[model samples]
Target: MSKESRKFHVPDALANLYDFANTLDLRHFTHHGIQHQQADELHNLAALGEWMRQHGLIERAAAPSQKTFEAALRLRAAVRDYLKCEPAERHRKPAVIGPLNAAMEAFALRVATIGKDGFALRPVTSDAQAGLSAIVAELYDAASAGTLGRLKMCAADECQRVFFDRSKPGTRRWCQSTLCGNREKTRTYRERHRHDPASEV
Candidate 1:
């Protein structure tokens, strides 16, 4: 795969890692239908660190230790959870996402001063704070513009994960078809066949 595609495409290692960290669902790591909640946080964090390493977001640190992975997971979970809230909610309760955006902007600015990573990294600086600030503003703009309506909850009864559905028909209901859709379809097919024997042949 092309390097950029490999780096950012959803379901790739990095994207999977990002998704895992951003959304905490136990099913991603389960084996034999048993959930492993204990490692959920740690796995999420480790995935982010791996994503950063692959994308050159942060300097490559050593392979994350178990403790480091858990800490990163906790830290990222806090940031992601905070970001998921409405801005008004954030204002009423200052929390990690606010500070993280601040810190990331600062880091972006610091990198910009060095003329190193280009505009992608420029969002971290003071001048770019306006742009960074736009992200928060745009959240409201998007809400006002009806853009937020594109957000959807996965159709799987047991999985309520949220996603932005960019499908042309806008009819997508599951986070992934191979995973949830197939399972539901298979169960339905069996149920119909069991009740209507003529269709089974």
Candidate 2:
């Protein structure tokens, strides 16, 4: 599968479900140039719905709801805002978390059968935003424990991609260094040298 399609699988090291919410790519430098989910297809609504299921964000059996889809998209933006803020600053958003709480309450936990590692907390939720909520809870849990310090939005002012920092030092500063980071650096370099006398012939 393509890399965008492959983002649904959450690694054990990166266990937050909120990672799935912000699927839109906003790296484009111009207005109205952003895309939803970055589908390989033309990114029609139907394609977006199909993509959601393929990534396991929405269940396969349930017909996706329009309300739910809008909420999910809004929730994604709210999540981005929450993540970008400092821990102390996160409390300033009741509007951002209202949907999160709604989604969280819609879902429940079920006890699964025995395993070598004993019982685990498995989420049980149906169609609509319940699935979205289940993942939001995970992000909150991770953030509360301070383990999500590595989760970050790209440092580049124009890039809206969220990235997980797996660096040994937990100091990763860009979503993708070759893309937004390099672009920003190049812009800065040109600005710095634009005023230099030696550059002007």
Candidate 3:
């Protein structure tokens, strides 16, 4: 799997999850040339749902199964839409952030109850629950205060990946510097050299 593909895996900690979620643009399900099959997509949704439950953000809905995975996708899409829209419009639409956050929180709670050893739902430990709760709290705080920081869209022409710009300047332009950034730099270098051969020396 590509580096981008690996990024979607459950993070090691709550802070990492928040950073990962913001950095990822769920609108583009495909990563690193891998088109998601239905099962693959479901897995992604399930993972997010699990993360949500762990964070104490949401309660388990009836029948937590693949169907729940599907529901999570819908919720994910709604959240994406909310983030994509203008702040004023998002506020005007009560169904946006409020519902989305609730869903996320509920999902986190359920996942927390299920434990954190793996994706499967099982009993959670106190430490796990506390960690998840902390993550959820921090995420909500950031969202409420509009201090989530610079959530960025990818600069690659064909890639719509989003990421958190955590650079010193908070002006990062690519989802992954080794990938999209390098590609852009190479392209610019080639173009410049082609246009002005003297500069190559």
Candidate 4:
């Protein structure tokens, strides 16, 4: 589990998937006179290797190839796209689901005898790229356990951050209600009252 996942109280089983999906931060909104900077943690093969190592998904010396790095980026993009859709409508949208299915083809996973259930999914390869497959396994497990639907992308266009929905009804829209959600509400309120004569100064 990464620091961000732990800080957010993400479930251990979905921690890796959560972290992998958040590799690219697309927040461009300014708050409190400070502009947020966009960042891609997997900027290159070296950075990818370091990220995997930090998450214990790869060895200290495992160097990812250029191809693997590209694949990782594609996977992240596909995941973000999928999360952008409504959970109930996700399956109905092939345009969003197809890319993720294609990106997952680069990595292979196999049944491993482990975990409390006496079985778990694991990567088949012995290379550093195998770490990517571990991420796939996490996705598969979460989906089967019916928890994958909770993973969602923020509705704020300026902050398309992926977040786990912990609401009882599982219908939360924004990642942070106090920030993104409030921003959206405030914007809507201003737009609604903009033409009202009674509100003119």
Candidate closest to the true structure, highest lDDT: 4
Which residue runs does candidate 2 get wrong by more than 4 Å?
Answer: 1-10, 13-19, 29-48, 57-59, 86-125, 196-201
Residue 180: error of model 1 in Å?
1.7
Model 3 C-alpha lDDT per residue in residues 172-196, reported as the tens digit of each score: 7777888778878988989888989
1-201 in candidate 1: lDDT tens per residue? 224334434323223223433345534434368754533323454564565455443445444445444444454454445444443455465565566555333222222333465322233323312222223333334456555444444666555454555577656766577777777788788988898969868
- Put down candidate 2 lDDT per residue, 48-83, tens digits, no spaces: 567566656566776556666666555565667666
Report lDDT per candidate: 0.46, 0.59, 0.50, 0.92
Full-model lDDT, candidate 1: 0.46
Residue 152, candidate 4: C-alpha displacement in angstroms: 0.4
Clashes of each: 4, 0, 22, 0
Query: What is the lDDT for 32 in model 3?
Result: 80
Q: Give the TM-score (vs. native) of candidate 2.
A: 0.65
Model 1 TM-score, all chains together? 0.38
Arrange candidates by TM-score, descending: 4, 2, 3, 1
Error of 2 at 55 (Å): 2.8
Per residue, candidate 4 scores C-alpha lDDT tens digits across 1-201 of 988998888999999989998999999999999999999998888889999999998999788899999999999999889989998999999998899999999999889888676998888899988988998988889889999999999999999999999999999999999999999999999998998888996
Candidate 2, residue 4: Cα displacement in angstroms equals 4.3
Q: Report the Cα lDDT for candidate 3.
A: 0.50
Pairs clashing within candidate 2:
none
Residue 144 CA error for candidate 2 (Å)? Answer: 4.3
